[model samples]
Target: MNTDIAATLPGATKTHRDESFPVASRLIAPAHRAVVLAFYRYVRAADDIADAPGLAPEEKLRRLHAFEAALDAADPAVPLARALAEADRRHGCGAAQARLMLDAFRQDAVKPRYAGFAELIDYCTRSADPAGRFLLALHREDEAAQGPADALCTALQILNHLQDLVKDRERIGRVYVPEPWMALAGGEEAFFAPGNGPARRRVLDAVLDRVDTLLDTAEALPRSLRSRRLAAESVATIATGRLLARRLRREDPVTGRVDLAKADFARAFARAAPALAHLGFTSDAAVCRRIVAGSGSSFRLGMASLKGERRRAIHAVYAFCRLIDDVADAAAPAPERRAAIEDWRREIDRLAGAPLTPVGRELQAATRAFGLDPAEFHLLLDGMAADAAERVRIADAAGLDLYCRQVAGAVGALSIRIFGATQAHAFALSLGRTLQLVNILRDVDEDAAIERVYVPLDRLLEAGIPDGPATCMVQDPRFAAVCRALADEAEAGFAEADRLLAGLDRRALKPAILMMEGYRIVLGHMMRRGFERRGPRPRPNRRDRLRLVTLALRGQP
Candidate 1:
């Protein structure tokens, strides 16, 4: 190799043995390992040039473009590129994946800060997702598995960013943690400060939770693969990712590297052994079920009573809602939020045709099977749009009602259809409003922390409190009176639902009734605790869960 070519491969000297990911591990067949290594070497070479310290950005771009052109021309002087081309000739592992990664390295040469996680994901689409795609292509895995594989790769990439947080900032003058996310920790400086542990922990944990959601999407990847070796490898890799995420949660990377021990590898591979015994696939419905169960949702307890397709349908619905809610609640700009919502809107339009995302595909099946109204989904989107604003404020009682109707009542309307009790739409709508009010009342401090106030502006005025910042509004003594008034309204709404439930088909609406009773218990706690007492918001205890379970089994609401 020429000296210039050798210079370009400075970072490529470190082999897969030095990396965290199991790149071309022994699990891969001997026939395929050479090609995988060839691909890794090519990517590693480009990454080296992009990350080389003291190198000018212009020089990095020129070298990367030259290397990319070299691969296209099958230039022999660039040994890694020639090797990959030869592998592609034998095994047909296309060069497109490597080119996407080169694009990412090109970006890395100039870009240092990400505006938001969405932008970071776009970066990952090039930097990380292609690696998974390349592996799947090599193993001849179905394209249907690509979503989960992309998720796994992206999750791992984000976790790497988290672990390298301090080092990336100090060494490369780069910060992959989004600027908006850092704002959650008080600002970039405070976010990295040694003394801001609690605030920093909250932000980091939120990022880890997002990673956990990605891992949940990835849980299906191993099972979906046709090759046993590849399946086992994926299983072990996912286990390692989960272990690292957990470790990152307990230990801060700001102080130093937070990584897995050698024992973790044994544990991960041991966890993968049972997977070899049964490589049975998981369906989209099962994936949605796992997502809902893992979410620790309050609705899970109520929805558990329904068996078979009804249960699957509700899980699909809830998962869709949860995903959209996450989009709305993300710490992003208003336009970005709206753009994400629009993307979902387009997805909704495609439901009757063929939606692209896992959640969308599952939702499409549920909507078609159960005759779920798409209009209700749009209403839910509208509600999310309201919340996705720069700040959330309710002008009056009617505004609150409309907001509830869009967010929760729309959910209720959809739930009744899936519950096989369309006749109980009125009851569903009433209960939805009541449940949302209780949620608003209980989450006052939490909502305030996020710059949201569901307390009506008129109610605040009536309490002699001026409309202002959410945190300020929640702190006033008069705010408790405002909450009490809403709680009374919620109590009345619950009574209306109870009356409506009495006249309906008790068997079909058992799930809805159980949820109603559960929320009523929460409302009871709030009433007894009093809004004036500022402690943890009221929630159902373990005894309440057992009682709900009993009621569910007995078919008694």
Candidate 2:
């Protein structure tokens, strides 16, 4: 199908926001509105040429290339291209996305028929992927999310084709229905015939199912975004996609009209209203996803193994933890830092009421959805407050455990709830301690530079070390023994965690299991290097990931 949405229904261009399709809506930041509209105008103009009733194939291609020339520099005659180029320069929106749309339009000018679904999907890569990638670049979102966004855009594109199939065939001899699909539906001529209503709807039902799954997968994209505007806008898009898919399934295309009222789109906007705010709005889920993907590669990998809502909830939890860490670690006076921690604790107290930030709203949503306690969140803030207090010093094993309980164990308990593991508090605490121990040992040098040490002072003194940084002390024979002891402690934590994991339903705990295995792998590498500076740190390489996959599959530690 031609990429122009306006081409589907005359006068639709004036009401793009009300249609079940993507456009820069009122949700976009005011500063970004002009650029987004420029991009749309550029693509819309190209789509117009490609779908024009009078334009020859060569003429359409020439006009598309004119847009490319505008991208390089200003074009007085091509106003749309000039505006798009200005948007690209200011927002870093790349010209490659525009070029991609051009390819789709050029193809549409000549190739009107697709032999198979694969061919049609390939067409969508150029046709649909560019629009989404354009939005990503405009908002400075991560490239990792573009694939999911593309899948969504392609599904929308397919839905549009299915809606316009008859109109396309009658108007321009374009046939989006693949030959195989027509053959299976009782041959091409019969399938398109008015008499073959049941057979056509049956075949279209299979295609509609595929669109449904794609739209479902696309739900992850909104949370994966960094920009609040983009995230909220994406939520609106997803709402529309879901509603349209239902319409396609319930209503017959051959006989019944699939006209969605403005009110239907209004309901979709209502469903995703969590993202809008007084000035700007963004999805908390999207914000958390960006934080996880940006902060830790290993944990993100493990979490990515989760499906749909489970993955989103965990990301929100991690994002909260990361936010606490940031507040504690911010460069400021100790008193101010402590005050910041207190503020977060108070937020947890009144979390049941209106939220003041995207993160708060998202955290509240996760708590309600996953049965998480506000006390758990408050405990996490207290842990941060511990580090914020005047140059934190751990004097003994009990002190270290107290610190770990507040920071890691509390976090583990929350994660347990999210992952559906009950009565695993002890196991969760052990996992947190073991992971914290690994991090402390791995960052010994870096931590010492900041005058912060997680190792117990008593243990260091017992090793016969005087007043000196642990960075240099870790090299001594007596301190190496302490390192060995610390490694042993971490191993025990892993063992306990593994034992608890053995009792839980294996499928839901896969992400947590992967995380444990990642740390265990690091611990093993640390032990081999005698827990020294040269030891491998806690990260999952391809080989480690393969082994983790095997462990998850076999349900073993």
Candidate 3:
């Protein structure tokens, strides 16, 4: 409460009561509550000093160093630090974890902009992760809980950064939105301009997608905790994070303050209540199901009849493909995309060891259960790296085939094993390529929007179009000729898949047949519309979904 000391001023006196989400509250037991508060106060004081206006960066650094020294020496002059030191002695919440936050605050005193999402995430690991780790340590929760807790904490911090975007920029001259992201909106100036709402919203939504992925990983935190009270608290925190993320997505933070209402907390607590009794926790299967269902992919319809582990295995495969595909097509610089791909590569490599990501953990189990090959996943990543370029163009039919085999065909190879159809490799390869070709036809306009033309360069040239920008190639009259020829090849591929399907076990390959039928229907739609026509690709309607489900039930599709 002292105002004389630079780091002890009441100017930054916000408490747990003032936070957007709960800090240390009644949810924490009385035995642990005081120590949590002490930790919060120490960190909050350092954050305030770093954000203090009219103070030189050197002065902020000096004050922060003094706070760290106070903790080291148990100096009472810095009352919050002294309190935290005493609390640490009692609770064993490591000072090392608390110092990570001090380091982040010190970075904030000097660093005003983030280079990219990865850099921003690194910042979050220091600024936010330690808080969750502190609680985990205090409660003596399993070390495995730390990964999900870090995920939840980092998500909360990013959500806070997004909510405080305008305020942070206007008040402290700091901008947490990655600079590369701003570049995508035409530059930092245009990105922040009031008139740039639509562009800013697109960028913000991409950031929110990243947040959603983090929340998905954090979904395990509640179930990972052993202490009933902490489990309940974590469930509430995760619910609050998810609600706030959705709110941020719908409401533009740039236009005004977008945040949660008091009712939101009540709703989160209501959602968390079931967890206190150690019930209603979401499992890895549930997370995978959500991902697959949320995608609106036709494959979900095919997998509908499966139950138990088989269904979970299918969902796991589809979710892995969907997530990596997201990384490939993200609205980021190519280098950043490639870097993200590398991170995925590392995650895939960890499957045999201790994997940190939620999807990876689920995948490891699925692979082990199904005897799935891990090498196929690396193949998928290789294909994604090809697409994560500044511009994408297939050189020829062979090139196209290789790309499809790597991406879609590899998925088929994995899925068939999960389907228990071990001998369906030929069927899987044929249908995968056929479906990918249909995808290329449907996504010509959409892919061109991102400077990607999956139509082979040789085909384009033979159709009398030049090898130039993807957008221009799509507009050329000759483009339709190339598409028609590819459509014929796709039809043949489908026929080959059907022939191969007849030789395989129908019971085992039912899911593949259903998916092939769905894609065939889409192909028929495109053929009827003609390749010359240009517009949004037709999506399966409710009627289409019902028909597919019917076929699946009949064991015919």
Report, for every candidate in turn, its global Cα lDDT versus the true structure: 0.85, 0.73, 0.86
Provide the global lDDT of candidate 2 against the true structure. Answer: 0.73
Q: In TM-score terms, which candidate is top?
A: 3
Q: By descending lDDT, how would the candidates be arranged?
A: 3, 1, 2
Q: Which pairs in model 3 have colliding backbones?
A: none
Q: In model 3, where do residues sit more than 4 Å from their true spots?
A: 1-10, 541-543, 555-557
Off by over 4 Å in 2: 1-281, 467-477, 532-538, 549-557
Instruction: Tell me how far candidate 1 lies from the true structure as C-alpha RMSD in angstroms.
Output: 2.7
Name the runs in model 1 displaced over 4 angstroms.
1-3, 11-13, 69-78, 140-145, 271-278, 331-336, 541-546
Candidate 3 global Cα RMSD: 2.0
Model 3, TM vs. native: 0.96
- Please write out the lDDT profile of model 3 over residues 397-505, one tens digit for every residue: 8999999999999999998898888888888888899999999988999899889999989878887898887888899988898889888999999999878887788
- Give the higher-lDDT candidate: 1 or 3: 3
**2 versus 3: better lDDT goes to:** 3
User: Per-residue lDDT for 469-551 in model 2, tens only?
Assistant: 54566556576677789989999888887787776776666677788878889888778777544443545568987887777
- Structural similarity to truth (TM-score) of each candidate: 0.91, 0.50, 0.96
TM-score: the better of candidates 1 and 3? 3
